[model samples]
Target chain A: MTLLSVSNLTKSFGGIVANDSVSFDLNEGDIYAVIGPNGAGKTTLFNLISGVLRPTSGSVQYAGRDITGLAQADIAALGVVRTYQLVQLFRQRTVEENVQIGFHLATRGGVGAALFRPGWVRRQERMVREKSRELLRLVGLESQAGLVADKLPYGQQRLLKIARAMAAGPKLLMLDEPAAGLDTQETSVLGDVIQRINDQGITIVLIEHDMNLVMRMATRITVLDFGKKIAEGTPVEVKVNPAVLAAYLGEAELE
Target chain B: MTLRSTISAKPQVWATALAIAVAVALLAYVFGRGGYVVTVMGFAVIYGVFVTGLNLFMGYAGQASFGQNAFAALGGYGTAVLCADYGLEPIVALVLSATLSAVIALIVGYPTLRLRGHYLAMATFALGLITYELSIEQSGLTRGFMGFSGIPPLGLGRFQLLSERAQLAVFILIMLLGVWVARRLRGSRFGRALLAIGESEPAANALGIQVFRYKLVAFVIAAVYASVAGSMFAHFVGYISPEVFGLSMVTLSFTMLYVGGIGTLWGPIAGAVLVSFLPQLLRGFRDMQDIIYCLALIVILIFVPKGLASLWSLAVRRSDVPAER
Candidate 1:
């Protein structure tokens, strides 16, 4: 079942086409990866689908709903959540508090309820706290719960972002360079954590430069070169695709 | 050196604020009734409510709004017009005026909040000026620069808060209530979203938090708070005028918010009390008063940039294990 479908999506910044008529489909319960060299518009494609940028032309159908031109939060509420290429934590809050922010939409209360502290709000808060801890444990940051978010090491911060994003209870998680600044050790753990997330029935699409992680995790792969889809298939098929190889010519990581 | 950024309010700070609340209520009676000191404390509490609202917007939600006085003017004049001119109940005037402020905030915040930093500040500043001008220009309704008097004292049914003693109790109660409400909003889901927006808009957006909607709601909430403060000021002093809710209020409240702790829970009230009382303490200096005030603020800005609550953290640092700032 297709959870997300991008057809003829194109975005241009003046004369430069950041994303030029890209097309792809993300199926439910599958780990999909989009890979390309620098300036291949991989991040641009993520932005267009996640509602950060409006496409010049083309439509995004998420669960058969045409979500083109919708606001980023609206798209997220519809279950498509993304992370930044550069980590964006609350910076001042505790690690646990950062994840609690993710559970925002799942819980319901207004300004009045916050002050009133009704019975239900208390119960909901306790439940979210427990759930937040469970997520931290999932990402192995449970002990760091009391520490400020920014005080965490860079690798842990990246993992913290995943935990924070997971708090939103997303059906589809789009990760932008989830392994951008991590060591090989951190990257391996990240791959395992993501697979565990995928195993639990959430669909994922990640833009990554790490070919080994991609080749290991992606059940299906989409390759883009200069804002257009150059090749896409199962990992084994795309590894042998000549166009994908040509696009990665001097910058070869397609081995 | 590391004690500067005290973002979260611990239970200890709240206990201290409550103690101050009790003391402030007693303060009105300590100097005796009908004295000038109670009037000063009364005004401080009123500004407490106003700055509480401002803190919610600027401190928590991480949005800048310079025009909250617009709503205060709305609340003040709304109460004056309804009570003094039309013979409405004071309580009804307060509620209706706050509602009116909310509507105005919705319309104004929509356009003004789109800008960030200096631009947003300039837009809100203009909004405040426009409201001030309206208060003066709409002579028939607002009574113009001549001002409006004979506004009824705050009361319900037949019990008027006539005495300075009675008014002080009422003011303290209202200020504490305002603090409770702000605390509730800050500690819960609503507040977390605001803090997130304050830190990073894009991150909050990606998490399904509506950044624009949250900002507008915060602005409206802050405006309602300003309106209540405005009405309280009008009724407490028994007069309403354009100058009371002018740009100077913007300056005064910002001072109070920073001195107390911009984002800390007790900061607004703490700042309000200290900044309000400091002026009277320096009254002996006469001509040097403003100079002393400027130096004091500079000292605070240089040493405790996060506000007085940051000092509270410093005070408690010895007894407790230091956590990540």
Candidate 2:
């Protein structure tokens, strides 16, 4: 079943088109990769889907519901969560605390529970803490849970950001350049973790520059060039397509 | 005893002890002092409540506001108008005044909280000016420039708090309540959300926090605090004037927030006492007092950018843990 569908999605900043006429369907429990060269509107596509940026035109349907222009928080509450290409952890708070913040929307109580701190709120807070610890353990940062997020190593910060997003219990997790600055070993570890997370029944949509990682893990791939979709197929099919090759290697290189 | 186990096992006993000690000292001062000292202490206690409210908006929420004094003025004038014109009790006047200030905050915050950074600051500053002008020009309601007087003092049955000692007791009670509220907010989810928003608005919003709604709530809560402080100030001083809640008063509150440390709950209390009593401490220097005050502030701002809380925390760290250990 399709978990998310985008139809004729278009976004522009002033006169520049960032995402133009983009359409795709994401199936349930599938690991989908979005690949493009620099300035191909990959991040813009993620932002549009996550509700961080409103579309200039077109529609987005998640779980058979249209959610084109919802606010980021509302979208997040509806189980669509995205991570930044640049890690954005709460620097002053501990790793555990940062993860717990992501659990804020998932807590049992609404505003009343938050304000009043009833018995249920305390229980919910305890549950959140336990879940946060579990997420930390999953991402191999359990030992560093008490450490301030800013104090963690750059590679660990990336893992922590993924763990933080997972704390929200998202149905669809969109990672923007999850392995951007990692070393070879760190990238391998990240690839393994992403695979494990996907195996746990969470649909994954990722934008990655690492072609090896994309080809090895992605069930399907959507290729983009200069704000338009160039190709959509299985990783093997996309790797062999001449248009996809030209988009990646450029027309002169193809010639 | 592994390093992690040792560090994690130790309770925050020192912070608890220090808080208790300070509470005791405040209690001793309230009961021991007489005349002017008690009066000054009363002012400090009320101002402490006022500054803590400002701290919630500026420090935790990361929205600078210069209009807290306007809220304070509304509270003071609300109390005076209610008590003098309507013959209501001071207690009733206090509640009504706080409600009035909160209503005004809602009106102002709805449009103003949408603005970012300096635009928000400038908009709130204009609000402060408008409130001051309205208080002065409203003539029959606010009594114009002549100022309002005869705000009946607070009382419980036959025992009215007319003396400095009695007023000090009431002020202490109010300050304790303020401290309790601040501490509660510090531990609450709403407080954490505010801190998150303060750190990064877009990140917090993406994490499912209603950023604008939280900001508006913080703004109104802070206004309510200022109003309560204003009502207490009017009753304590036995007068209410538009000038009491002017730009200088707003600056004084901002200085308290800065000098104390922005995010900490106890910082404003330490700041209010220092700024309130600095003039008396420099009374001997008469002609040079203003110069000395400005210099002290500049030096503190330069050396202790995080304010006295950072220094105090450093001192506590040194005393609690051995230098080599």
Candidate 3:
């Protein structure tokens, strides 16, 4: 069943059309990849879907409810979460603290709770710490929990971003270039983790330039060129499409 | 415990105890000195609360605001008008002033906070200028340039809090409450959210934090602090004037925040005491006092951009390491 549907979505910045008449439906539990050449507006589309940017004209229905023009925080609270293309962990905060911040929406202890009820707040904080630790373990950064996020190696920072997003308890996770700076071994681990997260029933949408990881892990693939969808299908089908070949892979071939 | 853990935990206690000690010292000074010192200390405590509120906004939420003094003026004038004219009690007037300041914050913050960094600074600065102009022109309500007089003093039963000692006691109590509130905010989840937003707003928004709401909350909370300070100052001195809440007071408060530390709670208190009392300390210099004060702040800012709080933290760190070693 379709978990999110976008119809006739259009976004423009003055004269530049970043996304034009884009239409797509994401199925529940589907691991989808959006692949494109540079300036294909993949990130812009993610921003629009995630409510960081309002669509110029169109509708976005998430979990069968129209969510167009909702605030980013509201969208996130609805279990739709996205990560930045650049690593955006709180550098001064510990890795565990960074992840625990994502639990703010789920945390029942407000300012009053933290102030008036120390025992309750301590218990809740401990629970959040345990959850953060578990997520850090899942991302293979359990030992680095106490370390400041910026002190981590670049690869670990990327993994921490994923762990932070996971701490939000997302129904749908959107990652922007999670594999951008990883080595082959780290990429393999990330692929495995993505599959594991999907196996646990959360849907995933990723924008990536890494074709090998995309082809290996994506259940469905959408190809974009110059802000327009060129082709979309099952991984093999999109891989064999001539338009996608001419526009995307052909450019990759040249570079 | 591990040495690292032990060192990390020691600072929290030491810091709290040290703050309480400083507060006690201030209390003792108020009791020891005569009227003039007590009066200045009263002003310092109120301004300390005002600057503490601003520190939360500028240091924690990463929003630059110059209109906090405007809110202070509003609270001062609001309380004066209510109690003197409308026959409300002093405490009721203070509460009303805070609520009014919060409402004004909501109205102003909603639109202006959308502007980024320097734009926010310029916008709020203009708002402060406008508020000052309003105070000057609105003669019927604010008494314009002539200022408001005949403001009533706070009292309970037969004891009027107008005397220097009583004023100091009230100021100390209020300052302690302000510190307690600021400390609470510093450790709360909302405080973390503010810091996260200050670090990177987009990342904070993506984390499901309502960045605008938090910013508004910070702004309003700071305004409330300023307003209460204004009310207390007006009553303590039994006089109110447009000149009392102007750019100079705002800049002085900002300088205090800079000198003390941006995000740390005690920084404002330290800054407030220094800014308020430095001229008196240098009273022997006569005409050169202002120049000396400015030079001192410039030097402090140049050498310690993080403020005096960093120096305190560094000292604590050194002491902590040696003890652990």
Candidate topping TM-score: 2
Q: Rank the candidates by TM-score, best first.
A: 2, 1, 3
Instruction: In angstroms, give how far residue A131 of model 1 lies from its true place.
Output: 1.7
Q: lDDT per residue, candidate 1, B45-151, as tens digits?
A: 99999999998899988888888999999999999989888888888999999999999899988987888889998999999999999999999899899999988
Query: How does residue A43 of candidate 3 score in lDDT?
Result: 96
Query: In CAPRI terms, where does candidate 2 land?
Result: acceptable
DockQ ranking of the models: 1, 2, 3
Best by lDDT: 1
Total clashing pairs for each candidate = 1, 0, 0
Model 2 RMSD in angstroms: 3.7
The TM-score of the first chain in every model comes to 0.95, 0.94, 0.93
Q: How well is each residue in A136-189 modelled by candidate 2, as lDDT tens digits?
A: 888899898766678899889898889989988899999999989888888888
Best by DockQ: 1
Which segments of candidate 1 are over 4 A away from where they belong?
A1-28, A53-71, A115-119, A233-242, A251-255, B1-34, B315-325
* Proportion of native contacts kept per candidate: 0.79, 0.37, 0.46
> Native contact fraction of candidate 2?
0.37
**TM-score of B-chain for each predicted structure, in order:** 0.90, 0.91, 0.92
Determine which window of 10 residues in candidate 1 chain B has minimal summed lDDT: B316-325
- Residue B45 CA displacement from its true place in model 2, Å: 0.8
lDDT of 3 by residue, A1-255 (tens): 999898988999999998888888999999999989999999999999999899999999999999999988789889998889864788877677788887878676555764565787778778787888888888888877767677888888888899999988899999999999899988998998888889889999999999999999998888888888889999899978888888954766745
